[model samples]
Target: MVTRARRNETDPDLGVLAGRLLFAVQNELFTSLAKEGFDDLHPRHGAVLAYLDEGGVRATELARLSGQHKQVVGTMIDELEALGYVERKPDPADRRAKLVCPTARGLAQARAADKIMSAIQERHARRIGRDTFTMFKAALIDVTDHQRRQQPQ
Candidate 1:
């Protein structure tokens, strides 16, 4: 038999709950990043930084991957370039196209962010039990994919 939990008037909706989780995680991630000498970075910068690849990516592709507007991603690319985190170069495949490639400093920052994020996830998994946390992550991924599919193109 399926049973639903009783709802209270004060219960948070999905948007609120998701926002709370995102904000908390980003706060912790950025705090650790600042300590690692990426103090210039803001949460908005994650719209680019988090989706970067060592091989390089086009600004349009980055925008698509991060779910941000192309203009916004272009602005971010400019900021990151000024900060010495990334640079633009001609794409070998298409000389007219520019590829955003990470600088040495950017690679270091990416490594640090990966380590910090892993530590955060490990802590949470430990708190909730490994199996439960794994299940929770899988469920979250499924929910996210479903919602994305529902969105109009």
Candidate 2:
């Protein structure tokens, strides 16, 4: 069996760089939110919050959009409900189904997250030239769109 060659320290892979950046941004946003009186909110909760609709969305749809297992999203919704961020109600279209809705507090949290993300993007643009940052974002969007298109529905 042939051993894989070691990667150079100075040239990290794209996945490594992406993970590091994501972690840093999440940490900063969580800390900022905590200071704004949202101490109960955790970065992982973003998986659900990011895809939430203002009106409401079904639990199954949330799981699909967040790329999380139904059980995992269910647990998260329970926690969010307990925290007064979300509530489960009978779906208007189908009474048999439940919709996960954001409370006023949850809406505030989403707004805060958006603001925090914008600030973080601005910081990145400043550190890496604005053009470079724009290009990076475009490349990421292109890759994500391509991959999404390739995935089986």
Pairs of residues clashing in candidate 2:
none
Most TM-score-accurate candidate: 1
Which sections of candidate 1 miss by over 4 Å?
Answer: 1-10
Please give, for residues 57-139, the per-residue lDDT of candidate 1 as tens digits: 99999988887889999999999999999999999999999999999998998999999999999999999999999999999
Q: State model 2's lDDT.
A: 0.87
Candidate maximizing lDDT: 1
Q: Which pairs of residues collide in model 1?
A: none
lDDT of 1 at 75: 97
RMSD of each: 4.4, 2.8
